[model samples]
Target chain A: MSIETDIKQKKFRSPYQRLALNLIYTSNWIQYQQVDGFREHDITSQQYNVLRILRGQYPSPIKVSDIAERMLDKNSNTSRLIDKLLAKKLVDRKSCPNDRRAVDVVITEAGLELLKKLDPVVDEWDNNMNAITHEEADLISSLLDKIRESKNNN
Target chain B: MSIETDIKQKKFRSPYQRLALNLIYTSNWIQYQQVDGFREHDITSQQYNVLRILRGQYPSPIKVSDIAERMLDKNSNTSRLIDKLLAKKLVDRKSCPNDRRAVDVVITEAGLELLKKLDPVVDEWDNNMNAITHEEADLISSLLDKIRESKNNN
Candidate 1:
């Protein structure tokens, strides 16, 4: 659906305004799919993301800051999110040998198993999102990067 | 910057995955700017959005459900968001004369003044996002809408 129909708004101040709204709205729409997929696993989408990041470095423990740096949502508190994983026993945390000030996080076997189950589901979601072709996806990705070109930190 | 550098990921399963990740990351980037702007005004972005929707219907009253329908984030609690606006005296709330069970919300002059103050700041942010040309913005918007085409609802 068009953003105008989605938001029930007839006009935008400029193309920039429409693009801005579309970005946020589209993100929310995609996020809902992720959130729903993880609901059955008793984890928030952020938690699922954290688990996947940890699984990516399964054999080696990762520093909390390093995890935060790689997160899609950079604002999440790694320590707090790790704490949730710890409570669920899906991840193990330990003092870093290299830096005592830092914590080393490793995904537990349970986390790996959970992700193993979720992998196919995630693949299916991505397949559904293939409504647009690879060329279109590449074009969109390039344009999005261009959209953030003016920002210093992005 | 490319999504790879932004998230420090070496590879994606497919172009679709890259586009999905890029959509979310860029939204977070844009939302942070909105959050910061509304922060100085002592309202969250969602609250700012609600106030703007109300102001757009200045002379008339709208229902809580109506406001939710127009919100960028569909999960926002309309009554709760309206309560925050009411606390600041930016809006007025009362029982709807047409439907005694429904509440009517109207933006006060204060809300209009607040939006006036915010208008220029929003414009500047949109201007900052003009890293792409108007044609690029239009293309991105259309592509984003196409990305959601496979879904039954967006």
Candidate 2:
């Protein structure tokens, strides 16, 4: 449905404003869908994001700052997020051997197992976007990249 | 920067997966920037969203369900969100004149004043998107709309 119909708003002043609102609205919608999927496994989306990042590292320990830089929400407090994960025993933290200021994080066996269990769920959840076709998906991705392209020059 | 550089992840199995991840990631990035702006005003982004919806109703009393329907996050709990706004005195609620099951809500004077104070902040906040040009923004918006469009059978 058009955002206009979806929200029952009368009209947007301009395509620019519409685009801004649509991007924010659609993204939040997708996030909520993902969040609900994660809830079945007893995890928040951010926690799932961290687990994915750690899984990417696998046997190698990742630094907290590195994880922060890689997070979907860039400005998130990595230290605090890591603290939450640590409490859940989903990840392990240790002082970086080279830089004491950095903390090395590794996904635990339990964490990897959880992700393996979640692999099908992740597949099913993202597949919800099957409402969209591959061509449109590629187009959307390219457009999003273009939206952030200006940030590249800076 | 690309989500690749931002997240330090190397691979995406397909453009579809890449687009899904990019949309979610870029949207979150934009949201974080917005949250920082709202944070300065001591309101979370979600709270600010509620205030804007209420302001749209102005003198006309809106119901909790109305606000929820118009919200950007479709699944948000309108009653709970309103409870927070009510506690903050940013909104006034009374028993609906016609529907006992519904509560009438209006932006309080304080709420309108606060939003007025936030006007410049919102404009300044929008400038952060100067990272993206107006044309790019429009294209991005159109692409997202298409992404949500379904092929007849799906």
True contacts kept of each: 0.82, 0.55
Give a tens-digit lDDT track for model 1, residues A101-154: 998999999989998999898888777777688998899899888778767744
Please give, for residues B62-104, the per-residue lDDT of candidate 1 as tens digits: 9998899999899988888888999999999999988999899
Model 2 score (lDDT): 0.77
Off by over 4 Å in 2: A80-89, A149-154, B40-42, B75-77, B80-90, B108-110, B113-139, B146-154
Candidate 2 lDDT over B4-50, as tens digits, reads 77667888755666776887787776777778777767787778888
Poorly placed runs, candidate 1 (over 4 Å): none
- Give the winner by DockQ: 1
lDDT scores in order: 0.88, 0.77
| Interface quality of candidate 2 as DockQ | 0.46
Per-residue CA lDDT of model 2 for A92-146, tens digit only, reads 9999989988889999988999999988777765566666667767766766665
